[model samples]
Target: MRFFSQRRRPFLSVVICIHDMAREAPRTILSACCPYQKNVSPEDYEVIVVDNGSAVPFALRDGAGLSPAPRIVSMPHPRPSPVFALNWAARHVARGNHILFAIDGARIFSDQLIANTLRAHSICTDAFVYTLGCHLGPSVQMVSTTQGYNEDVEDRLIAESGWPAKPSALYNISVFAGSSSNGFWKPIVESNAFSVPRQLLDKMGGFHESFASSGGGLANLEIFARYVQRPDAKNVCLLSDMTFHQVHGGVATSAKVQHSTFAQEYFSIFQREYRFPSFDAIYLGPLRPEAAKFARIGLAE
Candidate 1:
């Protein structure tokens, strides 16, 4: 069902989680949303912009003259962490049957993104949320738009990485897939990618306070697997055709000390969940010692 802006109540809520975004990034997202809103019926959806403790404050209430004035909620603390920020954002606002987590950085992909996503949603049933593409590309440039069933941005690493995204392999796989970069779904307020229904959120007691930062992707995967494993709940669904991911290239590897920590922690989690061969033995290519050590720590735990 295609949506037009004038419709009153919406079935879905688009949530944009932000933390210390550069001056122009937020504007770009809003611009993208304007055209998106035009295509989507307001009766079927709304947009919520969560200011996750940006270093530079912005006009959330005013929308700085953006097409739609996003309901803005500022966190009490200026925490730079995405997970914490998103939780705080979801708690204060976001009203929709399903929440689409759209990252402000390089997460926005094409004009028909949301429309395409919901189209895929019509056919799937599982606890799994559908993620579109896995393209890791230039941060600022609007990558070429491709048509057809698959609209994902292509990544040079897919062939070389040699890692498969199997359900059981969620432990070993990197959460940094090309498709996961951008996704559409209900409010996954607990920091997990797949938004659990209100009942499950209460049951799980929200995200782990110990699991800090954006690396919760792996934690989320584990959660997704466990939750869907229940006999009564098999609603998780993965819609590969509707999503696309764009990896921002602004930050260099050396600049990612904090993210690396999360990566290390994830590897450890992977080790605990899976009895894969030695890290080096399983790796398709060379494994960094630090990366290997983190997995070892998880094993020791």
Candidate 2:
């Protein structure tokens, strides 16, 4: 079902990819939309959610309260990897000059995410912007889940954090993921939320469809490495912004999977497909008091 907003061409387009996240997608969408995100109007950006063959198709009611509702596209026969679905939206549906990929739909954005992204682009039109990745728990979900953390525990943590009413409070409950363990001062392997110019994305042919592993198996890392390697690209990391991941039995974050075994298989595929590169980013945005503590943690590392 199509629910295109009549807004003008937005400066940014966000393509969120999800597969069987019926329980978590609503909060994720809400966090990226109006009232929750600060200092940005709906006209400034558009969100396109690509449902990658969920058992239960995504419905309009999942994003009911969102103003200028997201464009929901379903891929009934989606490949195991989300690379194809994400690429299809960027190539056909996205109208913004710049496109942001939320490779995991369960991740929620910080309040100033959109405003900070626009500011970074304005600073350098060729900027490749990303935020520090975080998990919505006392520690990374992969570890915390082993300690009995689940969606019910995560929901309680969110309520205690005072989100929406006080969105910055998200920092109180989150920890840097293993990919982002080095913190803001250092480079992370990949970003759950990252953006680039439409032209550049097209030039790179969007995500590499060759990454056919379940949940795109290191596909996000591949794209980030490729984009940052461009001599013309400016890597900007948002110090005050982040994407908080919600636990929903994801391939990498769930206790249901054998983490080491899954990592070994995916890394082997990644190694065969592309060369992994270390990334160092230019930190941007103010170090707000709420986020200052996390910055210190990264620096301490």
Segments of candidate 1 deviating more than 4 angstroms: 1-9, 31-34, 37-39, 60-68, 103-105, 116-127, 136-200, 203-206, 213-255, 258-260, 263-301
Q: What is the TM-score of each predicted model, taking all chains together?
A: 0.54, 0.90
CA-lDDT, candidates in order: 0.40, 0.81
- lDDT comparing candidate 1 with the true structure: 0.40
Encode model 1's per-residue lDDT on 146-262: one tens digit a residue.
221111333333334331221112122223232233222321211222443333444544333444544244444434444544445534333322222333432221134454565
Candidate 2: deviation at residue 289, Å? Answer: 1.2
Candidate 1 vs. true structure, TM-score: 0.54
Q: Go through the candidates in order and give the C-alpha RMSD of each one to the true structure.
A: 13.5, 3.6
Residue 212, model 2: lDDT of 82
The residue-by-residue lDDT of candidate 2 on 245-275, one tens digit each, is: 9999888787454645545655676665345
| Candidate 1 C-alpha error for residue 130, in Å | 2.1
- Model 2 lDDT at residue 140: 86
Give me the overall lDDT of model 2: 0.81
